[model samples]
Target: MEPLGRGDPRARRPRGAHGFVRSRDGLYRPEELYDATPYSTSSDARAYQWSSEDRSPDALLTRALHDESIDQALGRWCDPRKLVGVMGGHAAERGSQEYADATRLGRTLGATHTVATGGGPGAMEAANLGASLAEADDAAVDEALGVLAEVPSFRPSVDAWVDAAWRARALCPTPSPNLGVPTWFYGHEPPNVFATSIAKYFRNAQREAILLMICDAGIVFLPGAGGTVQEIFQDACENYYATGDKVAPMVLVGRRYWTETLPAWQLLTALARGRAMEDHVHLVDTVDEAAALLNRPPVSRPSAPDAR
Candidate 1:
């Protein structure tokens, strides 16, 4: 499959106060990351390589600068209060019910809010795919889904998986924009292509924090393993410390899975007790219910901190 272009010419570089340097180097555009043959030569691959091998002070400084640049861009363009995040496992295959549910959740939320995710494969990719096709009809979405099912997972071949997504992307030429915060730390899980705007970082901790913080409208936790659980409590901690007006809703889908399987809901509910976030926390049976709960007016805007 043919890769995308190297960079976005449409992006305006941020000029320095002295009008000499372009201060904001900016994050990799979707095209920039995907462009090249054999995935190894792609910008995503090269960036991960550098992040993995580098240890010099200059490299650290550059990584910090790059992440800060991305933060500045997000600040200027996206309304953090309107961002709704979806957190789930990366193992959900494309044709699976879990993937389909995440996709529907994203489409529904994307109708009103900008969908955001961890930006890797599985549920993250599904949500991004749904958001991208938010403006399309059901038939078009179904067609795209069918196209993606050809390559369900990124395991055997990430290139094949990406190609399938690219094929699916054609169904919605003018895709609804969405945000993705991926990290190089998890290099095994390549970033998905459906995220129109990707804010990829070298540090996973910074990426996770930024992803959770920007979802001011709140986050919907899809059934997932360890990573999803971490997001739930991380978001809960933010809401737990937030004032009454600043607390964002946290909706967890799959009551039985969370309560019986993982049993995180018990602790989550207990933690919400006697706090401003008590009423904001909810347990739902489906993504439909989660979307409905988060469809209300947005809470106070949460601050988006720089990666440094």
Candidate 2:
């Protein structure tokens, strides 16, 4: 379970090579997380295990450096403000109606904007899958869904799950580019393969904030559990005090789910009262409605200073 570092005898690249520092690193492709094949145990899995077992200085340093690299890589990806984020529970099974809705939501949003997700299985994977095939026809999307339905969960075998997704991807005419931000903090849930570029981190807090911050285009939250609830408010908190043109639309799909089942909307609306975000928050029943709200004419704002 040893990580490749300064003391590793098999090392070829120096410490300044990609992934060791901010300057040298680049965004990760799904294949970069694997040792050899997509079916094999990922470097992320191995690193998580090593992190849990080792509390040494070097181990801590490795994690820190990796996170820094991810931050740098993210800068090269795209304008964060243009990214539309999809958040939901990881428990939604492949064949379930909820999974289908998330996928459709991603597809709709991906048609106009770059889609970003938490990069785990279930609804997150579903959304990323849809975004990747945004340019393809509806039949292709349905076929991919059918292929994924074979393996509902990744619990018993991640290999089988990944194999199915790879097969599904082969059906796409032109896979669109998308972003995935997964953290090793929740190591049990592996990152999905659908996202073209990944910025994986070791810190969950950093990952969460960055995900919310980058989605200035807005976030569409689907039915989810504790993590999803936290994200709703976290984004709300940012919007609450934000000035003109800083408020990003917050669309929560599943009216009953947000109003009755989880009841986050009640408090969310209360929080947005008398604020600039009041007009920006919405609760809708369908993914199409959510997409419509997000796809509305962009909010007029002052020009930001050039980056670079």
Candidate 3:
């Protein structure tokens, strides 16, 4: 046979002169890395050895679910405003007080924002779920819940994770839109189902960068782990340089977390004191304060003729 063309069926096969040939075992493939066929009862004991190996059902299901989620997220991210990310720890449990706080934040933002998250449990789920619950209209809430109920908290089994999410949605309907920008690298924590949509990624770094870039107003950083810290610095760098189309506000929530936990508050304060970035940063303790800072009108620059 001639060399495989790019558009040819054989092109999909492994390249080079290693032509397809049957092995001694009667398998019709050179790369017989694994036995992947069924053995009949009439076959000899040796025949069973070459029989196909079955992959773990759970693993197969998880992969399929993950692929589907990634595809869904990709579709959602096409519209930037459809996403609003919330970065926080996956360790936050379902019923914890911290989870409740995160949920409250989600609700407040969800009322006006699209409400996006890292798509795992804890704070992510709390925020999405809160937004899902804040819907005043029953029918609209039920529709949203039905859609999100497909995937619940991240778990060992994709089936369970998806089922739980669907259950949660069924239990609490939502009229507003929410999203989860989860990562397959952290696949153990499935995307929260409460999110109306998802924008999952293979790389956390790329996912985070995209999340920060898309937020028109800016992100709100709650207490979190290394991931949250990384985001804080990244956001600061963007603001300091005025990297994007406009210099959006970088509002840091939780004074204690910024001041004590990470000391970012101190760093931002020092940077602001330098005059170059005096009005760029606003460190606050409450959501209301952060919202107000974001909504404040921009100061107009003096015209050159007027200045002279």
| lDDT by residue (tens digit), candidate 3, 1-308 | 12234566645533323222111111111012112222122121122222222234543343344344444445455465633456678877555567667776777677666776776777878787767676555454444444443443344444555555555566654336666666645644545557665555545677777667666555677778888888877866666555333455666778888888788888876654433334656678876576456546643222221110
lDDT of 2 by residue, 21-79 (tens): 32225777886675545444567677667666767666677677767767877976765
Better of 1 and 2 by TM-score: 2
Tens-digit lDDT track for model 1 on 1-308? 11222464423443222221123445456777888878888878877776787676666666666677777877665754489899999999999999999999999999998999999999999999999888899998899889999899988998899889888998788999898889889987999999998887777898898889888888999999999999999998888888777788999999999999999999999987767788889999999999999986654443433222
Candidate 3, lDDT over the whole model = 0.56
Superposed by TM-score, candidate 3 places the C-alpha of residue 227 at a distance from the truth, in angstroms, of 0.5
**Which segments of candidate 1 are over 4 A away from where they belong?**
1-25, 297-308
TM agreement with the true structure for every prediction: 0.88, 0.89, 0.62
Candidate number with the higher lDDT (1 or 3) = 1
**Residue 258 lDDT in model 1?**
97
lDDT of each: 0.83, 0.83, 0.56
Per-candidate RMSD vs. true structure? 5.9, 4.9, 12.6
Regarding lDDT, does 2 or 3 come out ahead? Answer: 2
